[model samples]
Target: MAAIDEQIEQVERRFGVQLPEDYRLFLRSRTGMSQFVPPADDYLMLDSADELIDINEAGEFQERFPGSLVIGGDGARELLTYDFRQSPPPLVLLDTAASDWSAAIPQAPSLTVFLDQFPETGWIWGGDSR
Candidate 1:
């Protein structure tokens, strides 16, 4: 956790933004690459929310849920599903950073985690948003 905090501090310094509470929690939970964007055919436990259908599938994950704040649609699942047992998106953490980074991107007013917001097969911010 200290390492994460250190990294967070570094990010804050670099971006001059303060992360939000929910976003901070999500970052602290998974300081590395999130476990939801890969393999394209397995149902992996995403976050503390609910199981999010795999976006790798027919791309229905984004269709069902659009303009969502959270990004959950990878892992090994076939369909997009929200996982309530995993952490939220890294963007959430950036939003919680209480720094300039938040100002540089979108945010969830209520921290309502969503699945479609995440890219099904791509990269964002060095894949941080993936």
Candidate 2:
């Protein structure tokens, strides 16, 4: 697999925008979603649920899938995490799990697999972004 930075850069180049500083930092700090959990409003308020993803694995999502990351947070605070994205060849979802109470993505197979999604929000793990 490519280095995290390399993967991030690839996503940015393909998407045509620089991710937020905090987002970049988060990516640099993590390697995958193994350490992450669903966040509150991860499904209802953000534009791209993918936006709520850990920064570390963000690039991996981009590499696996190329379309925008929509995340909806508390009370209609919807926002687009990754805009205008796409997926790789022969789209498929990999290591993805979603249930009535949880959704976990070990690695995504394709971007299309993530549409119409909701994260296991209402609780979150990890330190403050502040």
Candidate 3:
């Protein structure tokens, strides 16, 4: 489902941070997806705008991830996130149970790249790139 500007703005207001332009564009077109089976064989479920707020707030993500936003996750222990600690806020894969930020693994430089190359390669794991 595509999200309107107001809905997107609501998400930003909830987090007190502007989402990356590329990600905003994604939400405009494909706000979320469910049970998207990629080549990695892991089921990917993207969160809708409302779900984003619910997930983040319910999980206390602000305290856990600091400058990052949880966009989606594998049904299990992994999460696809936008690490906002840097300019452009590169997307990353993180273990939900991670004890420190250093465990974040680089997944894509941007959401556009992630979608463009998603079928080719799903979430990347097992790296210490942060």
Choose the strongest candidate by lDDT: 3
Question: What is the model-wide C-alpha lDDT for candidate 2?
Answer: 0.36
lDDT of each: 0.35, 0.36, 0.77
Tens digit of per-residue lDDT, candidate 2, span 1-130: 4476776676566566565554555566654232222542443232221334453154354454345443322232212233333323211112222221112222223223232232432322222121
Query: How well does candidate 1 score on lDDT at residue 63?
Result: 34
What does candidate 3 score on TM? 0.85
Q: TM-score for each prediction? A: 0.32, 0.32, 0.85
Between candidates 1 and 3, name the one with more favorable lDDT: 3
Across 17-106, the per-residue lDDT of candidate 1 in tens digits comes to 454465557667763244534434233333422111122122342233322223332343222222222244233222222222322232
Compose the digit string of candidate 3's lDDT tens values, residues 1-130. 3347888889888777899887777777775887866565567878877677777775566788898789988777788888878887888887878866788888888878777777766667667342
Residue 51 Cα positional deviation in candidate 2, in Å, after optimal superposition: 13
Output the number of the TM-score-best candidate. 3
Who is ahead in lDDT, 2 or 3? 3
Q: Itemize residue pairs with steric clashes in candidate 3.
A: none
**Local error of candidate 3 at 37, Å?**
3.2
